[model samples]
Every structure is written in C-alpha cells, then in structure tokens.
Target: MADGAVSINMSAEECAIQALADRVMSQIADLFFAQHITPTPVQQQMLVSHVRAMALRSRTGEPLPEVEEALFEDISPDSMTLAQQVVDLFGNLPVEEAWLLSVHFEVAKNEG
Candidate 1:
C-alpha cells in the first residue's frame, strides 16, 4: 500500500490488516493508560514501530521463532492475553509472535 492511495484501491486483505494494526495500537494505548502506566515518548514510539513490524511479518506470513525461553517467565497472564488479542487481530498468526508481543509489553511495563 503506497502513500496517498485511496482506501477503495486497497485490496480487502490489505485493508483488514491495516484495520487490525490500527485497532491493536489504539487498544494498547487505552490499556496502558487504564493501568495507570505512563510510558515515555520514546517507549511509545518504539512500541508503535515494533507493532508495525510485527503486523508486517504476520500479514506476509513470515515466521519468528528465535526468541529465548527465559523470556516466557516474564510474561504475565494479563500481558499474554493482551498480546493474544493483538495477534488475533491479524488472523491466525504464529503463537511465537504473540509471545514476542508479550515480551514487548513486559519490557514496557518494567521500564520507567
């Protein structure tokens, strides 16, 4: 999808993925604020980029299975659930991607 392209021109698959990513990011900001967490400007920007990359990978049907097992323990149920919800937005993406999203959230939570 090139810049300035009209919405009607984009295919259904492209639209769906874009919608999912948009919603996921919006919901994430809501969730973060609801939890009384104030992420710094840099943290917010980083998460946006991370989510965009993850969305691209998911949409393109690529795989990312090189994460460390130790990272699992840091992912709380709440984080995992949020990650799953975000991942589900892009259809049946690999579970590893969800876990990776959880890792991102966990890191964000642990940060200032």
Candidate 2:
C-alpha cells in the first residue's frame, strides 16, 4: 500500500454549501458594483485584491478573522450603512443560501 493519505469527496450537502458560499460572495460583489461607490481605480483594485485574498484563504482552513477585518474596514461613511442593510435584507436565507451568504461575507471581509 502507498503511504499517501486517501481523499474523500464532499457529500451533496457539502457541495451545495460550497456553491451557496460562492453565490453569496458573487452577490456581494454585484451589490458593491451596482452602488458605484468604488469611484477610483485604486479602490477597485483594492476590492479585487481583497476578493482574491479571501478566495485563496478559503481554500485553506483560515477562520473568519479576514471577514471581520474586511467588514470593519469597508464600513465607512458612504457604504457602511448600505452594507449593513444588505446584510439584514439577506441574512435569513435558507440553509444552502445562508451558506452561500456566509461565503460572500467571508470574501467581503477579506476584500474590505
């Protein structure tokens, strides 16, 4: 027998949760783009940089520290309240959707 570890695939429920997380992150990105608050190139770059970082971190086993940090940084005079509203509006989605939303929040936290 080989010494390598065996790999086990995720269940259907796990897959759904992963997909949902992606959707939530995409939704947050869409919301930010729609608001047009990112007026400068630097700002856009910042957002994208954060998103990428978050995505990479997700692949690893990092906790939600990045998420919290991003939220705190991004919650400014113009967009903070809107972000809060968006969170409230979509907070109580179903389990799958909620998972997606959590993913988005994680991404957003990293991005901000």
Best by the lDDT measure? 1
TM-score to native of every candidate shown: 0.69, 0.38
The 10-residue segment with the lowest total lDDT in model 1: 103-112
lDDT of each: 0.76, 0.46
Error of 2 at 111 (Å): 9.5
Q: Backbone collision count in every prediction?
A: 0, 4
Candidate 1 colliding pairs: none
Question: Best-fitting candidate, measured by TM-score?
Answer: 1
Model 2 residue pairs with clashes: 20-100, 21-100, 25-104, 70-109
Local accuracy of candidate 2 as per-residue lDDT tens digits, 34-78: 764333455455544544444433444344432334535433434
lDDT of 1 by residue, 1-112 (tens): 5788766788887777677677779988887888666667887888788787777777787777687757687689887887787788777687777787787677677783
